[model samples]
Structure formats: structure tokens, C-alpha cells
Target: MTPIGEENRGPGLDERITGALVGAAVGDALGGPVEGYSPDQITDRHGGRVHGIVGPWHGDDWRTARPIAPYHKGDGHVTDDTLMTHALVRVYARVRDHLDAYAVADHLVPDLMTNPRWIPELEAEALPLHRVFLAEKWLVARLAYGHVDPREAGVGNIVNCGAAMYMAPVGLVNAADPAGAYAEALDVAGAHQSSYGREAAAVFAAAVAAATAPGATPDSVVTACLSLAKDGTRAAIEKVCEVAGGHGDFES
Candidate 1:
């Protein structure tokens, strides 16, 4: 196993882990308020591109706002994405070992269900369960209530990004080892996702793992993703990269 704090001639593993986790939280906070809107819509609503932290979409009435009601999704507040990421970090801290589906059942589910933590989006202290989206709630339902085996719990849930969204930790734990990250993420994600969703989690973990390697670059990360990704996931990434190659910048 790769040492947790190994430094392979670039930033130390600890630094990479901090960068990845902090970056994920910041991006989540920035994106949460405009999550469902298109880029054009967001630009129009914000009177231009969002360049920094902004307020709730509905301002003072955010508590009663439709669609985003009750959740204060802006002003540097992180949505459940960051919350799940932190939860996964705690899981790793407690386990002190690589995790799999059973680990999610034994540790993650209980953490979500029993713990009352400060939830930024809710602007109050509450159980993580209350803030979790439906797909995530499936973890508790299947394992805690439905008595489903952890490895198979994800079989019938809607194929979505729930598992992939917070999988950076898996990649971090398996730093510089994209293949290891891919395999481990597949096992861990089996508790929450299947089919394309499961595959996406693994591929995303691999991308992060690849990025942590010494001298890794965007091209290298994409190469790692292509090497490990499969089926529609692979085709989709290839198409995106192909289309992206024609553009000079995001604004194009």
C-alpha cells in the first residue's frame, strides 16, 4: 500500500490531500446556489459570471424560496456535497484503513444516521441524514432499514452521481496509484451506486489519483481516466476531451 504521506518528488501526499479536500469544499460552496441552472442562466441571474461567493438566490427569503427552500446554499455555505466529503474523511480517520462497501455499512451509514453536526446549508445543527439527498438516503434505507447486503445495496438505486461526488478521498488514499483508486472506489461505491454511476465513481477516483502523481498534468490525468474508464463513461469522457480540444478556453 502506498504510504499515506508519501512524497514522490512533488507535493507531499498530505499537501495534495489538503488541496483536494479544500478545493472540493470551496467549489461546492461556489456552485451550490446555481446548481440546477445552466451557465447562461447563472450568468444572467448574477448579472455576469459568478467570480466569488454570493448570497442565496432568493436573498432574505431563502428560507422559503422554491426549489432551494430551507437550505441556505450560498454565501460560502457548502451543500451536502462537501458534507459527504467530510463524512468520508471521518470514515477514513476512524478506520485508518482502506474501505469497501461493508465499511460504508458499518461506519458511513451510522455516521450519517446518528450524528448531529453543524450543517452549513441548513444554517443550523442537524443530522446529516436530514441534509442528504434522496440517493444518499438510500444508503441508510437499504443497509439500516431494508436489511440489504452492503455490496448489493446500490443495485436498484437510480444511477446518479451520488457515489462519485465525494469519491476524491478514495483517490487521495490511493494516491499516485490510479488503478488502485479505481478498484477501491468501485468496491466502496457499490454500497451507493451501480452500473454507470458505479463506474463513474471509479473513473473519477482514478482521475484524482492520477492528478496526485509527480509531474501529473491535465493531459496525464485524462490519459489515466481513458486507461481505466469503461463503456459509456469512457465514451463520454473521450467526447468531452475531443470537443474540449477544439476550444482555447472555457469562455469559447
Candidate 2:
């Protein structure tokens, strides 16, 4: 098992894991309506963007994968990020321990290929057939080296936030152990994302681990994210905090 409690321990074991997964899904749905659109665009489209839990979340546009429907325009639909997180959750439910790179690659690569329902709205942007083949090739390479060569792994048109967005669940399973979460997230995310993309995945994973601790508030989770993220990501988090703060209570 990926050991937790190397440092501060927060929640009960089950609660932490469950809370992390639930929180990630909630965050994804909360942000889904605003996905891809800038703040200005969102304001222009909707009189004012709802801060949290807006209703009538719609599927993303096939062409742009941006939320665009009237009234229900960009509300709270889950994305590939949350779907892949569920996939990881399934794997953890089965294994109940840390999985090596090859095992993770075996599960993830095939899922990416055949799981048409994983993220229905964004299927139009799924990896092309050739990239699927390449992913398989890199999976083999990953098996050989115990880690895929970053150069060979992420070379394709499939680059995006897809891999990073779903990574929170991995950290949830390894709650209170930021290092383990970071390591596992890096191993899995390496198959599909690199550079800043990989970094983003790692940060989110770390935050999940932190948030899973008992009594951890949203602000604490955001602080954990700030601790793990790089300058750009930290800046983004700051901006999000500013927006969240300005909105007062999000549920209102």
C-alpha cells in the first residue's frame, strides 16, 4: 500500500479517500461549465457565472469541447478528467495498494483505446489511432525501463490537460502521503503528459493527498496546492482564490 502519514495526518482512512474522490468530482463538475472559456467569455455568455453547483450542466461542444448550451450553458458536467479518475479509483478498489508503472500503463493504455464511454463529450478529441499504437509501444518501453521515456511517451497530437485533470484520485487513494501520491501520479501521468502538464498532474495529486487529511478545509487544500505547484500554477491558484473570495460563499 502507498503509506500515508509521513507527516500531518488529517482524516480517517476511509473518509479521507472517499472525501478526496468526491471532492475532485465536485470540483470538476463545478468548473466544467467554465471549462475552456475565459472569464470574460463566461460573463458575456451567462449574465454572471454561478460560483458553484450550477444546474443543467451540458456536454462539451464536439468541435471545441467547450460548454455551450442556453440556460444550461456550461453548468456542471464531468469531463475526461473525472472519468479517468473513476477509472483509477476502480483500479485502486481492486488492488488496494500502490501499483508499479507497468501495471498502471497496462490498465490505462487499453482504457484509453476502448473506453468510448469514459468521457463521451470529449471523445471527438480522443487520441488518434496512430497515437494509440504509439501509446502501446511506449507501454512496452515503460515495462522495460520501469518508467516510460518522457521523450517517446508524450510525442503526439494528444497533448492536453486530459491526463492531469483526472490524477486527483490517485492521490486520494494515497492520502496524507504527498510523496507517494506524487510518485504514483508521475508514473501514471508520464504515459500521457509531460513538462508543465505532468507538473500540473503532480500538483493536483499532492493536493488531493493533503485534502484527504481529517479536518482539512478547502483553504487548506488550496494551500497544499500552492505548496506543490510551480510559479505558473501557483499564480493560477492565486487568481482562482481571488475569484472565489470575491464571490463570498460559492453556494450562494
lDDT of each: 0.91, 0.61
lDDT of 1 at 218: 89
Q: How many residue pairs clash in each candidate?
A: 0, 5
What CA RMSD would you report for each candidate?
4.9, 8.5
Q: Report the lDDT tens digits of candidate 2 across residue range 78-154.
A: 65456667766666676777764554666655554455552433334443222222334454344344455543465
TM-score to native of every candidate shown: 0.93, 0.63
What does the lDDT come to for candidate 1?
Answer: 0.91
Give the top-scoring candidate (TM-score): 1
Which ranges in model 1 have alpha carbons more than 4 Å from their true place?
1-10, 246-252
- Candidate 1 residue-wise lDDT, 1-252, digit = tens: 777665466777678889999999999989988888998998888999998999988889999989888899899999898899899999999999999999999999999999999999887999999999999999999999998999999999989999999999999999989999999999999999999999999999999999999888888888888888888988888889878894222220
